[model samples]
Target: MLALRARRLFDGQEMRHDQVVIVKDGRIADVTADVATDVPAAVDLGDATLLPGLIDCHVHLAFDAGHDVVAMLEPPGLPDRMRQAARQHLAAGVTTVRDLGDRDYLALGLGLGLDGPEVLSAGPPITTPGGHCWFLGGEAAGEQGVRKAVRERAARGVHVIKMMVTGGEMTPGTHSHLLQYGLAELKAAADEAHAHGLPITGHVHCAQGIAHVLDAGFDSIEHCSFFTEDSYAVDHTVVAQLAAADVVVSLTVGVAPSPVPLPPRIQQRMAGMREALRAIQAAGVDFVIGTDAGIGPPKPHGVLPYGAEMLVENGYAPLDVLRAITSAAARVCRVGERKGRIAPGFDADLLAVAGDPLSDITALRRPLAVYRMGSRATGRVGQINQTAPTIG
Candidate 1:
């Protein structure tokens, strides 16, 4: 058992000041403001904030954070690159990451502690024949192909199923952001995945594709860029449907690499992504933060803190942005009860930052300590018999 006293605590939603949190058997035993109780050890951390370990909803554990990601995936080096990427994610203070696309179930094994990041992975993205991300070699054709693909992935113990409903900007030689999967085929994929007890996440960009994703009963939509020739507007009806169906939207807002050269019109559409997010938030759409970390330039997994900062810049409160990375993300990933909050029976995955992240988002970039499952996993405080830095 261990007791930790912090200047502030972000318990998934709100911030509590001068609180004491008890941990036992890798779960939060109790959190209170009263007197500190008896425990094996009590660590007093003054002037710092304790928060639930962050979760990155969309990451590619196989890609290095660099330009020319496609070239990096060529051949003969994918396996080693995947392992290095997972380790970087863990060292960067992300305790959990959802790998949207990978070569195989390598990310899944890493999540099971074979490597790192508590990975939840879709073995391979389900795409149309020669559709977006065909380079990863997950191209399904008819309904039979889609069914077979889902069964094979489920048998491989994938945590989720990813489908590319439209082409994306990052993928070369693809069609415009429109429906790639027909209604019948998409419905069949969803039905098959659900039958195997797996949720599906669709990669959608344009308005029509987004509508189809909603109609096909996908568990979530990635990107949902909502681009049009004239303006950007989420079909409120589709938003309403997604809300009604309890479907989530993994808004990949800041997933793109910064300042990439692009046409003016594409840049304009990219600029409007935040407005779309605001609209979705206003409509009470269930959403989570995902940095499409692997596809874009400077692609590395576990860059979610940057995305979280973008959420605040886009009009979310600081605490809400934190939840977007913590509870909200876990909820979208369907690991809510186990991985989100800092309460009893929850995993003891936690992070301590130097200052109150509610005041300044950049504080998240520097984690003083990272604890996974009731053990001190990483960070340097001090050796025995010496007090650590108060603000670390």
Candidate 2:
């Protein structure tokens, strides 16, 4: 067993000072304040805060985060690009990512290993023929068609089912305000997915679409932006309903510092989007951030830390934000049993930053060390000899 000592530890739920986490056979053996005498040695990380590695609930490894993401999909070496994207997330201390959309199920081939974060993919998101993301090839019409689509993805071993309930900004003919699938079709897809023991989430923008998904029994909603034809508005009633129903919202947030300007339409909606998010938080709706990384230049692969910072800036408590990205996200992704917590029997996927993130959320960007399943993936953690004294 390997003992990793850090000045502070956020064991998924809450913070504890001066803790030692023990790892054995790629899982956490124990986490205690007192170091055992028989333990071989402790890798003491000075002035660092240890946390369960962040999990991005929504991502698209197939997109290259370029000027023309759809065009980039047509090129060769797409799988290699996807792998590189996964590595960027891992290097940024995100140990798990759920690819909400990808082309040709490429995200599934990214094996769970130290090379990259553990990827839980939804293959190609189900959409209407010629609807949003139709280029990704997940197109079905009618209730029977939607059910067949869900069954196909489930048979392929996808962890979740993603359906386009509304149009998206990325697709030219599709409008974010318009619903893509009818209520009957949405219900069919949700029923088929749950019947196969998989959670189904919907890509929703307008308030109407959000309500439609909730009524259809979707487990979660993505990009709950509340977009209208000309602008966006947050419907408080729907927000209240979401909180009451206990539906998780995967808020699409995070924009990395970049010289390139945002797209004209998105640039105009920034202020409105912020206000909508504020309303969601105010209504006590459960939320986790999904950077929508790899969708544009501002959304590069490792933008989750920036997302945490954005939440803190917008009145979210650091402690709550931290849980949303770790334990809460794992539970939403249906991997809480193994991936999120820093307790005994959990995967030893830990991240140690240079300072306390609770006090300063930006500290997350300064990763001092990252461990993936008991193996050091990046950074140099300080190691002391067994004879030398170790920190708690």
Candidate 3:
């Protein structure tokens, strides 16, 4: 048994000051305003904040954080690179990550104590033949093909099925805003995944793609970048439908400043992205914070917190941003009850920050310690050499 005392405790939403949290057998035993009796030991982390471990719902563990990740995927040494990437994410306070796309079950093996970050993997993203992300080798042309792909991934023990309903800019020779899969194919894929007791996540960026995702009953939509001209009108009817279906929207923010210049029209369209985010928040649609790490300018590993910080800068309260990364993200990733909170019976995965994160979000960047499964997985202590000759 261990007791961790912090200056502030973020128990999901509210931040309580001077809280003492008790841990036993890798689970939070109790959290109280007053220290509990019969505690075996206590570690007083003075002037630090305690928060649930952060979660990044969308990350490509197999891709290196580089400008040419798409090109790098073709190399023979991709597996080794992925393992290193996973470790980087763990060291940076990201205890959980949902791998949206990867080759084979590389991430699955990593999740099962093979490497780092309790990974929830989509073995391969479903895509039309030669469609977006087809380079990763998940190509399904018709309904039967889509069903077969989902089953194959399910048989391989994938936690979710990721499908590309629209094209993206990152992939060469593919239009960013084009819709790829039709309704029939998408419906078949979703049905097949549901039958196997797996949720489906779709990469949809355009208005049409969003509509199709809602109509086909996808569990979540990745990068719902609905670009518009005047008022940023994203089909609210579809947004309402998603809410009714309890579908989550994994919004990627703080992608880092892009060096490439966008055309005037597309720049205008990109401005609407935030409006769409606010609209989703107003509509009460479930939103999770997922930085598309390993893509564009956002470096992999430690970049997730930057995305969370962006949420706060864009009008979301600090607690709301925390929820987006914790409870909300876990719920979308289908691991809600197990992780994401510092409550009883939840995993001891947590981060200890040096300052109050509730007031200043940047404190999250420097985690004094990280605990995984009730163990001090990562941290250090400095000792001064008192015996050494003193310079007066």
Candidate 4:
């Protein structure tokens, strides 16, 4: 058994103080203010705030975060590169990630053991012929074809289904504002995935695509950017619809500070993107952050901390951002029972930072220590400003 006492704790929901978390057999045994004196080992983290390890709802481990990830995806060394990416997230205190797209189902076979985050994978996203991300090899047409595609992914044991309901910016011939799959095909994919006991999410951009996917009963929507042919637009009606629907929107956010500016197309739409985010927040839509990590130079595998900061900077409540990255993200990813909370019977996946994130959201960037399944994956207690001494 091991005990860790911290100055404060965010139990995946709210903040508390003077808490001690006890771990045994790779799970949290208890989280209480009463620290048992009989515990064989104890570690005191001074001037630190403990939080449940973060979860990134969307990432593409197959694409290395570079200027041209599609061109750089060489098959021979892809798996090794993916492993390194997963470790990057782990080291940054992200203990869970849902790989929404990958080449040849590689994310499911990473076999990273205790050193990496728990990976939930969608092997290859289902898309229409010549549609967005067709290069990843999931292509289908019509309702029947989409149903079959979902079945195949389910057979491969994918944790969720990712279907392209619209084109994407990454593909040259595609248009992010255009719908790729019709309502029939989208509904067929969602139904088939649900039949197999898997949740289905759609890659959508335009308001029409978002409405279609929501009508088809999709569990979630990704990149709800509401783009038009040339510039971007956020339809307030659709935003209201999203707020009233049962679906969750995985907002694409976060950009690490890098010398490379955002792509010209994205850079031009920055104001509209911010408007969409603000509208979503004002409408009180359910949301979680999906960094779209590994798709560009500004987005790296471990960039979730930046995402939390981005939301807070954009008029979002810091506490809400905290929940979005932790408990709310876990619920959307279907790991709510075990992965997100810092409570008893939960996996001992925890992050300790040097300061209170609620007060200074940037404190997330200063990770004092990370514990995955009770094993120290990165950081050290002594690294904090205050010296922490081990006790036994």
The candidate with the higher TM-score, 1 or 2, is 2
Tens digits of lDDT, candidate 4, 224-337:
988889999999999999999999999989988776788888989989999999999999999999989898778877888889898898899999999999999999999999
What C-alpha lDDT do the candidate models reach, one value each?
A: 0.75, 0.89, 0.77, 0.89
TM-score, cand. 1 vs. native: 0.88
Sorted by lDDT, highest first, which candidate order results?
4, 2, 3, 1
In candidate 1, position 118 carries an lDDT of 80
Candidate 1 yields a Cα-based lDDT of 0.75
* Candidate 2 lDDT by residue in tens digits, 1-392: 78999999999999999999989899999999888887886899989999998999999999878777888888798999898788888888998999999998989987647888999999999998899999998999999999999999998999999999999999989999999998999999999999999999999999999999989999999999888888878788998999998689998888888666888888888888999888888888999988899888888888899899998898889999999999999999999999879999999999999999999999988888888998888522322111211122
How many steric overlaps does candidate 1 have? Answer: 3
User: Which window of ten consecutive residues has the lowest lDDT sum in model 4?
Assistant: 383-392
Model 3, which residues run further than 4 Å from truth? 34-41, 111-115, 227-245, 256-269, 379-392
- Residue 184's lDDT within candidate 3 is 92
Q: Give candidate 4's whole-model lDDT.
A: 0.89
Pairwise lDDT winner, candidates 1 and 4: 4
Give the per-residue lDDT digits (tens) of candidate 3, residues 47-99.
Answer: 99888888998888777766566767776877777766766666667778898
Better of 1 and 3 by lDDT: 3
Models 1 onward score TM values of 0.88, 0.95, 0.88, 0.96
